[model samples]
Target: MLVSLIFKRTYRPNVNTIQWNKTIQNHQSNGNYQQALKLFQLGIEKNTFQPNSVTYLTILDICKELKSLPTVRKIHHLIDESKNLNNDDIQNNPRIRSLLMDVYIKCQDIDSAYKIFQSMNERNLIDYCAIMTGFNHQKQYEKTFELSKQIPASIKYSSPVLCTLILQACIELNKYDDGYKIHQYGKKFLPNNKIFMNELLNFYLKFHQEKQALDIFDKYQNQQTIIDYSLLMKYYNRQYQPDKTIELCYRLKNHSHIQIDHIIYVLVLQAIANGCCLHTSEQIYNQIKKSQTHMDINNALINMYGKLGNLDQAEKIFNSMSKHNIVSYNILLNLYGLYYQSDKALKTYHQMCQHGHQPDDKTYVLLLHTLSQTPNKINDVKRIFSTIEEHKRGPMVTAAMIAALIRAQLFDEVNDLLKKLPKENILFYAMKANSNETNEKFHYPISITNEQLALYDLLMSNIYTYAGLHDRLTNVDEILYENKILKDRLSYSWFERSNGKIEYFKSEQLQLKTCEHTEKLALINALDEQKNSSSPILIGKNHRTCTECHDYFKKVSLSSSQKKVYLRDSTRFHIFSNGTCSCEISS
Candidate 1:
């Protein structure tokens, strides 16, 4: 019972360099970065063991994980002083160079990363991917695309992630053709890659290929993250389908699979603004306020309120913000214009300038619109018009200028101005784009009369209708039918109520009854089609309202208890009531 058995214990305190390195690797792998660093320092201090390639690689990983430039510099210094790095095997490793570049990039030292990348003798796929990623992070989109092209010919194609980065560059630069080609070239790699798919969706959306964007989203909705949903929502917003954006938000919420973020909330707020759904906007606002908010949300609230004609609320939001950027000022300025508060708009413009916010083309356009509405500011309008021309504003501004000139009834001056306008100006393009002639290279000075301007206004105002009709006119039978319809409708006719049914007259009937102008006949037909409303009837015409129709609408309005009729001829707006037209423009 008292037998004692002796067991030998293996107690060895000495550890070799390989054993220490293994321990450090295990520590780093187990997420004990501090312990790993401690062990590494102890080994170097002891001087009995030297750091090896494994030790250096692990240190690089630690530097990248920490994203600390100071720690990276220390590790790089050690690498420079270490004699173990003199080994051919350790000195010639391409992976080491690539990892160094990645670490520098992660720490925001892009120049250092580029230097390391350039110093490498034999660049590999990893090196190219890392540098391109750095360029993308820095937002050097053109450089990113350019670098992608210089990948070694030996590497026939880049990886999916690299290709996605290149496509993103293309998206930022709006290189549609190049993007499409890359999409085709990389089709084999796109099936399961979310990043690639997102950039592709962006490309399609920007080019107005909504159907294509929808198809891609539908194909990948199950695999989509929150970012994907936001992309799709933004696409819908661009297309003016706010209802669809709201529907998508609901769909995302109902699934409850993805966690919502502030960015998504901002986009949803924009959608609500577009929809003018006050109730939904309030609900979303409450939700965002519960969490941290972003500046974009505040800006979007201002935009939504402004769009809904809630100027007071928009102003309150704008005033409450701690800081305001150019966009905030622009939105406020635009809202003032929308509400026809020209004085306030000019004040806001001055405020914007005072705050060092340079006005953009859109700003000038909004100012021009307000000035066009206020005829008393003709002198100010002229100065602003000249400034806009000096700035070389687009076709829209040119159109607005034409409208203002015609509104002021300066027909002779308008003709002279049109004659003097440069051949390459937007005014020329607007004239050519709206012309009925089929010549591609048609020169401008394209007829400078009131009727010409009226034709321009009508074509511009009814752009969608004109486009549809243009397409339909390619068929001979359709053209004949449309002409017949136009011919039979009377210029002064109204729809008659018969047996609880609306009876519409044809152009031929109109021609037989009275020789009213075609434009007036269309208005009559429209007013007659909606006979129950007491509000003003608004109509647009390609030419001046003939005296006959002008007299007719005035008489009708007077007899019908002073109901108003608003008409826009190419020259000016005519509001006829009580046998009087507001314009007083006698043809």
Candidate 2:
């Protein structure tokens, strides 16, 4: 009777098997994928019972979830050893192969995925798409192209994913002609599919076909994805159309189906900041405050306020932050340096150190620049230059330091530093500094310094002699006034302008009998050329403008129908209009 009962029973899973399967299912359902995999590994190691096909399938799912190649390989080995499991089973079930292929591809094991793909007897559209995607992911462009060409026309045309992959390949290779042809062929598949449509739009943008790009965007902007909006904002920002960028930002904000993200806000903030529209910037700031609190948003606001020249507001934002990063301090340090607030810049640097932020190369560079402007901070400049040399910074910092020294009129130190500088043209001939030294060797090498130095010498001599002065009221002016004859003979006779034409007016042209100022010569030439138009004439004087040119511009402004004259003298900018100069009261 017992034998009869045993013979009557069918092969059913025992209690252990039922418990193991339930545990895996429970963990997987709960999204505890790693625990699911670990329990499966433990069940196999126990060898309590033989795993059925369903068990192997569950293991494959876990491997795919983990995207682990080693575990997939272990499962593949176990399946090969099992008598019940074989390639025939895999061949019969394409899903197992697809799962394995997905795991391999996700692990960036393109070769293994390709082998699995090729082993399939009857390949489908998905298999072809998966392999092509693998190649694309690996940036194996040639392999992708070769595989794409081999796909059947019928299969390729029906699969939008395949078509999109081919388009991406063409885009990556910068094959504009081929991409355009393929895009026109696949236009029918792009209506409802945002992924492929964006690829098509990207192709047009890559080739700089703005009209075509905009046309494509307008056709599909209603159905575009978040990525599509981001790309469009980037394009507009690149084109310097801040208004369009902000418009798109507002549009994205109002989209019912789309959720605005922090990344989009960061990009839009850059656009509005550059527009200098502080009103729009304030609105965005309020939005960011409501929904987001990130270091990036804070940094962008700091940059925007700095650009608008509101350092107090920038500092307020900086102080409001509970946390600070290197970039945050960098922004404030650069702001102080840009405005030439040496004390504030130095204080910011010390504060950054106190906050445990290590200074980078840019920090040191900004400090060097600030120190250069503060002539009284010469000792700090020396210390910073030492740090720069210790870190083996490049020639730019060294060059800047040398230039700072020269501007400070520390010519002896400049000569010593120039010898240490690398053999660049600007640094090479900087050893020569004295203008009164008669030795040709001590003079700047004309070949390397080029004609700019020649022009500089001519301008300097003009100011040194005060050749345009109406009266020698001061004794120092009297001695220089007496030395004009030899200086005038040695100075430049003519100079050139941007029009490729030379204006030849010797010192004889000066209303002053002794000499003509170089800046006066250039101004007279510029005004005479553009006498008919009532536009401001810009003149750059390398040295301080002589009293004669100052008086001349005032007279020119009043007499020439209010023709403004802007003079950028050595120290500051002076605007002359209607017989009045900006520096009139200060002088």
Each model's lDDT comes to: 0.63, 0.65
lDDT of candidate 2 over 422-508, digit per residue (tens): 664333333333234432332222232212232233223333333343322222222223434323332232322334233443344
Model 2 weakest 10-residue run by lDDT: 471-480
TM of each candidate vs. truth: 0.53, 0.58
Clashes of 1: 11
Candidate 1, after superposition: displacement of residue 582 in Å?
13
Q: Which residue pairs show backbone clashes in model 2? A: none
How many pairs of residues collide in each model?
A: 11, 0
Which window of 10 residues has the lowest lDDT sum in candidate 1?
1-10
lDDT score of residue 244 within candidate 2:
71
In candidate 1, which residue ranges exceed 4 Å CA deviation? Answer: 1-120, 134-158, 169-193, 207-212, 272-294, 319-323, 352-361, 378-428, 431-587
Candidate 1, 302-404: lDDT as tens digits: 8877654467899999989988887787777666654556677777778888888877766766676666556686677778778654447655555566656
Candidate 2 — which residues are off by over 4 angstroms? 1-23, 32-35, 67-69, 80-87, 90-93, 118-122, 131-146, 250-261, 278-294, 324-330, 341-587
